[model samples]
Target: MNIHDRPFFAPTRRLALGLTGVLLALTVAGCASGSRKPQPTPLEPVAALVSARQVWTQAIGPVDPLLVPAVHGGAVALANAAGMVTVLEGETGRVRWRAEAGAPMGAGVGFDGRRVALVTRANDLVVLTERGVAWRQRLPSRTFTPPFVAGERVFVLGGDRSVAAFDAQSGARLWSQAPRGTEPLVLQQAGVIGAVGNTLVVGIGGRLVGLDPDDGRVRWEAAVGRSRGANEIERLVDLVGRVGRDGDVLCVRAFQSAVGCVDAASGRTLWAQPADGATGVQADAERVYAVEANGRVMALRRSDGARVWANERLLHRGVSAPLALGRSLAVGDAQGFVHLLSRADGSFLNRLPTDGSAIVEGPVLVGNTLVAVTRNGGVFAWRPE
Candidate 1:
């Protein structure tokens, strides 16, 4: 269902009668004014200050917005709903390797150069290597966030709010964290999971928790959101998947609640601001960027969480999470157009095009090329010229 503010549910399975779905529809309608969806803002004449060119195009079949292109050095790993995973050279768009999971995938392409991990709809965590499928392990619950591959281990954030670890080589169960309190409803979208320093940082509900990677012990926790809504559906506050990382500090969004930065090394909340958005954020050294409910792009000062600039020209465009590449901010819209904006003042820099379909997720940069996969499964790469 297309909500006027933003997407609360990117449904692959039918949630036709769920209370969350119904309440979300009502909640989004309350935010919008007119009876019909707003038309996307028309583009003005393009500025020729920055020049970019299409580098290469590859196909991997159609993908949903859940799939984010994983980059490792010069290689980028991507997967489609049909379980076809392809690794391509980022610069030349050459196929490095390809593998199939033999089932419909739920989430995937978590790569650490040598190890690739994906989860199937049937709840199997499939790990692949350059050679082929390395091992298949059954998970305790359904997963949305991609398996985070690091420290010779695969860490997964399950939809049930469980965290488990497996050996990268043998697929042996090392440690598991049981679901943390009873949550009324959890987001079907991916939650943030990654490694910062020696601590494995994970988003469990609205709290950013840091656990010891060695034995999976809780080291510290920082709250980014709280359950203050009137109902269970409104009370749902889960961290969106992507992150803005500058050294040990990480910035993440608590679904439609707040955006905050956390110190991974010390487990401290640097700052937080009330923000109504469902997608995660991107950041550079100076600023943290987010796309709000109505497609407003905001740049927040990294140190103090102050508003730097808010650009509303892309409103109602159904833009994806932004990619902070070099000096420009790039985001793909529903019509398969990538708009580049100035990072300083959020001015329109340039416009790029792809096959007429939504880009599946945010763009990933590799070696000087920005790679993006479309909802129609068109993988396009653009290099600055």
Candidate 2:
């Protein structure tokens, strides 16, 4: 008998028949009782604490829900769903250059100072220089996380729980390494890769692995969260959002599990605190900021992982990842409102409105300018006065 076809309790054939009848009766009873899943909390208007104005706006075509803009040097590189890549002046929002890909973009517009890399929906990697297309290569598997470019290498996390590196100048494959354990269930929106010193930090399967960039060898691995519960769904604990790093500290959040920090060099866990967030965490020098799955914004002490403060007024507002900006933390909501909260107390400091569409991805902090992209392909930049 298929385990999924029948409830676990109905192990015997006779019990399975009876369980089916009982389940039907219970389903009818539940319907009669008018049981329903809990609805998200309604959004409430809050008075702005400070004034934030948009410096500029640009229409770049609709962006993929999983991809975020890449900022390098003083330019921001963005790829829309239609395979158009635009490089803009970070402060002025002036379009510097634009390129169109042969296929729809799947993963990134990961930019270093030299080259830009993006994956196509056809599972091909396309690299571009300032002039035009540099090279194109096929990936071994699909990818949702944006490609990470550092030094002379570009790194990507694939759907098959593997991390691969390629030459930044040429499209040659450097090395590919898969994570340990069973082919664990992966989260669709929960993988990230970046460089911290000489180590490549990858968030996958509820853990963070520090890999040597030169050879893609696992230098160390640290668990952000562990699997628990009876079923695979409940046991899912992949790390969500971007892995945050500040100096020697690295922080990450696990889906519906916990948030933790670790020493980047030694792989020693600094601290892990229970947190229920679907998105990732961002860090400044002192605090790590995160949005809980239900839209609660939280600030945790970076040193020991203690709760600094939390604001729940935006609960269920579909908050994006938090961006740490000096004394404030900025997060976007479903309604295209970019909220700035006090880093000290989590109080609302200011709010800015976009094109009235949902800000699906978190804002990127380029220098002092906060850049945000809405679901409708609206891009805006703001700086705190």
Candidate 3:
């Protein structure tokens, strides 16, 4: 039987309803007031620095609002709203394999070579292999981020304020750990986890934690930002978007708070700059890129977090995370337009339009192609010309 179809206890249903109401209230209060300025409309393209043409397009299924494509081993894996998983060839967009979970999916696809992991709407973890279904384990709570598979373990961050690791091969629970602090209500789109060397780097509620992947013990912890307000709504500082790491330097952003980088090994704060954004930060070898809540994209020197450049042309366009593509940076907007800007000076170089729906997640760079999935369930691949 599908896990989501299982019955819920009366008390559990009540608690879920209460949490839903709280989340609704928080969403309403989070939007800026009438005092805020209007956003700029997308400007006309100046000149084409590099031509981008769609290589292929495919329809997996209806869009799973929370799912983003996972790329590994020359393949891009996508989970649609209908609980179907499709693996497409990176170069040609050909379907390699397709499978179904028999239930709706909660989060995106997480993959590592032979194994793929996904979370179900019922809060269960499902692992798939080339052969077929490997194992399925019920999770303690719902998850939004993809299951992070590294080494022999798969780590999942739960909305119940915990990070749990399971044996990748056997689906046995290895260990579970939570952050240290009062659990402020977390955003549904908030948590992010990845591996930095041997440690599992996880961002939850304004703090970045490095966990020992083997035992789920705390290796190091650093605050990306802290709450200063009195009420729960005022204290909702979460690490937004995906945690970015280039070498030993890891950078992340806190919702309505700050963006900073730290040493992945010891959790030493390299430098932090005050900024407000719901999107995450991206870093190359030398600089970190951030899109503020207002849609202004800023580039900072990775060494000391000095401001390199800021582009305000796309202000309030609902930009996704900035993707570093060679000498240019790419960002997708709410209107499904991908804008390419100069990496050195933030000058607008080119723009391309998709299905006119929002690219809910940041574009994934696969080899020389940019893979973008729209909210309308359009998966597109563009190659530079």
Pick by lDDT: which candidate is best?
A: 1
TM-score of each: 0.91, 0.87, 0.90
TM-score of 1: 0.91
Name model 1 segments beyond 4 Å from true: 1-35
| Higher-TM-score candidate of 1 and 3 | 1
Write down the lDDT of every candidate, Cα atoms only.
Answer: 0.80, 0.74, 0.75
Q: Write the per-residue lDDT of candidate 1 for residues 1-385, one digit (tens) a residue.
A: 0000111111111111113222132443243344777788886887856788998999999885567678877899988888888899998999998988878888876888887899998889999876788999998787878898877788899887889999889999999999887665767777788877667788998999988877789999999987766766667788876788887788999987899998877889999899888777897778999998778999999998899999999898878888888778888888888888889999988888999898766777888998878889999999866
Error of 2 at 269 (Å): 0.9
TM-score: model 3 vs. ground truth: 0.90
Candidate 3 positional error at 249, Å = 0.6
Which model is ahead, 2 or 3, in terms of TM-score?
3
Question: Which digits, one per residue and each the tens of the lDDT, describe model 2 over residues 227-253?
Answer: 876755556677765667676788888
lDDT by residue (tens digit), candidate 3, 178-257? 64554646567635777765677787677888777777888888887888566665567777656566767788887777
For model 2, the stretches where C-alpha displacement exceeds 4 angstroms are 1-48
**Model 1 local distance difference test score:** 0.80
Candidate 2 has a TM-score of 0.87
Comparison by TM-score, 1 against 2, better one: 1
For each of the candidates, the C-alpha root-mean-square deviation to the true structure, in angstroms, is 6.2, 11.0, 7.1
